[model samples]
Target: MKDVDRGALAISAALAGVAGYVDAIGFLDTGGLFVSFMSGNSTQAAVEVFGPGAAVALASAGIIAAFVFGVAVGGVAATLLARPRAWIVGGATVAVALVAVLAFGGETTLWRVALLAAGMGALNTLFLADGRARVAITYSTGTLVSLGLALAAAATGGSRRAWRRPLLLWSSLVGGAVVGAVAHRGGSPFALSLAAVVLAIATVILAVRPSTPERRPAAER
Candidate 1:
């Protein structure tokens, strides 16, 4: 977060919100499955393998595979495209929009969940620095860890403001999840459409904004 520019940080926060929103919807719709938090899905899969059956475990495995595939696609796009952030966000927008369409069309839950997971996978590629994602938008565990470290550093006379970004990211995700839960309860049918609209707007902003040059790690420099 300290290394990222203001514009990039804002975009990353917004993306995190989207991730939380979608994840909430997916959780409710699937009744315990996750769309973005692969760690949770992995644990669930492991438990299901022993508890429920292979068939239940396979669902999480499939979502994980889809996420990996989306990451591969986004990684290639990042390497090849001039405006990788915009294009990657655009790709995510498309995936999310498709989920909304399928939901309206009464499509099966499996495809919707898969697409949600894939969109989130692509979203994580939006802010790469030195061949790694600078921000993990869909998950809060890492952000919380960073927050704790930043707070510790501050107590030890490090930069006092270093914790702000991590806090902001985590707060945004929680806020989005709250909104998503309310929307899902009130307007369940339109919850996904709302997410798609948010992503579409983000795509436009990323497309028009000047690209930020990738910052290399100190060792590389």
Candidate 2:
């Protein structure tokens, strides 16, 4: 693969892992709701809305709304920024760090959840190119499905490279969740801080002068 492709894939997988980490932290904090995984939250929201958990339903709706708002903000920022990849990722790192600080203050309520949602939402913009994402880093439902399909294809003699990226993305998420879950046992701050540190490292890696361009291939040269 080309240097640029490698960089994109690397950063994409890293952010996916970060998303999973933060999502796991959010799940633990919220007593079983997702920050990055909207589908899961949506389902829970429905269950709560119809069940006896009216308060929980309201919180779920708020989280969903906050996540959508964050996605919109991230998309606009990526469109307006001069260097979307670096700025978006870097901004997300900062956002997650703020969540860590807030968590340290014993504030793991809606505010922290909003920040986590925004951070992961911004992360999704990192791989956007020509209005299409090269990889989906914030969610893994499609990634898992694609991995399964690729496995079936490989069983029929397909190339291994065709499945490697999806597998890496999937595994990274699971690994991150494990780390986040373990860290959450210490405290919410610890979990958020861990995610922030990884995202910060990812930001630096993307900011460095890479041997090849890390932006979209079709970007102006």
Candidate 3:
């Protein structure tokens, strides 16, 4: 995060917020399943295998597979496109918009869930470096871990500001989740539509802004 510029950091935070917002709606609608937090979904799937049944586990597995497929598609786009950030964000906007459309049309829950998961999976690829996600926007576990490590480093007389980026990402996600839960009371479609709008704005910003050169980690160099 120290290597990343302010513009990229701000954009990454906003993208994480969108992931949290969409994930909250999907989690509520699905009664427990997550659209973005695959680690949680993996745990749920493991428990469902014993508690609910294999069928339920299979459904969770399907969501996970959709997320993986989205990552693959986003990875390819990032590799092939000159403007990876804008194109990838645009793709995520389309996926979330489709979820909103399907929700409004009374489409099955499964389709909406799949699209949400896929969109989030693509969103995580926004800060990819060396074929790995530099920032995991959809899930906070890694962010929190990074925060902890940064705090430790600071306590040992390292850079005191090192923890700011991780803390910002985590806070954005939590704030977005709170807003998402509130908006969800109106309807999933409405909430998801708003999320799509946010993504669209992000896409436009990425399109207009000068591209930031990604800084690879020391190990990668």
Candidate 4:
């Protein structure tokens, strides 16, 4: 891979760690609802709306709405920060802060959780808009599917054999989740602290000069 892509991939890995941390804690505390995977939330909301009727429907709807709202905020932030790579790190910062508050704040509530979910969605949207294919650092459902497909391609005798990085991405996520879960077991705030640490590290990586940059159009360059 080119140096620029490599740099982006490394950044993505760190962000993946952040995502996994967020996901693990979100799952543990939020009654199986997933914030990073908005699809899951949306699907759950649909089930609540259609299956059990309007009784528990509002909960799923709220989660889905919060997730979408987070994504919108992230997309806007990413667009604004597109030119400067630091913006990606900035998104991470927001994620870490929001999660910390929701997880650790003494006065946190359900509404706070909803706000945190939106913030996570926003950080994830930043990753999406970054246009780095390997950097689906915020979500894993598609990453797992991609890994399986890539492995299948490799098994089918195609020379495209590019499973290493994708595997790395997968492992990073799982590892991060494990770390987050363990931390959460100790104390919920601990998981968010871990996330903040990872994001801070990612920010430092961005601050470092790149060996070589991937050239983009003048607008992005």
Best by TM-score: 3
**After aligning candidate 3 to the native by TM-score, how far in Å is the CA of 137 from where it should be?**
1.1
C-alpha TM-scores of all predictions: 0.93, 0.89, 0.93, 0.78
TM-score leaderboard ranking: 3, 1, 2, 4
Model 1 worst lDDT window (10 residues): 212-221
Candidate 4: tens digits of C-alpha lDDT, residues 39-122: 776777677776755543676567668867866665665556533445545565766677676665574355655765665665
List, residue by residue over 18-111, the lDDT tens digit for candidate 2: 8888888899888888888888888888888978997788888888887777777777876787666677788888988988887777756886
| Least well predicted 10-residue stretch by lDDT in candidate 2 | 212-221
| lDDT tens readout by residue for model 3, 1-221 | 67578988999999989898888998888888888889888887898897747776877888998998889888888777877889889999999998888888774477679877888898887777777888878789999999999999999999898899999999999888899999999998899999999999999998988664633445754
Global lDDT of each candidate: 0.83, 0.78, 0.86, 0.64
Q: In terms of lDDT, which candidate is strongest?
A: 3
How many clashes show up per model?
Answer: 0, 0, 0, 1
What TM-score does candidate 4 get on C-alpha atoms? 0.78
- Candidate 2 off by > 4 Å: 1-4, 210-214, 217-221
Ranking by lDDT: 3, 1, 2, 4
Which segments of model 4 are wrong by more than 4 Å? Answer: 1-4, 50-56, 82-84, 105-108, 125-134, 211-215, 218-221
Residue pairs in collision within model 2: none
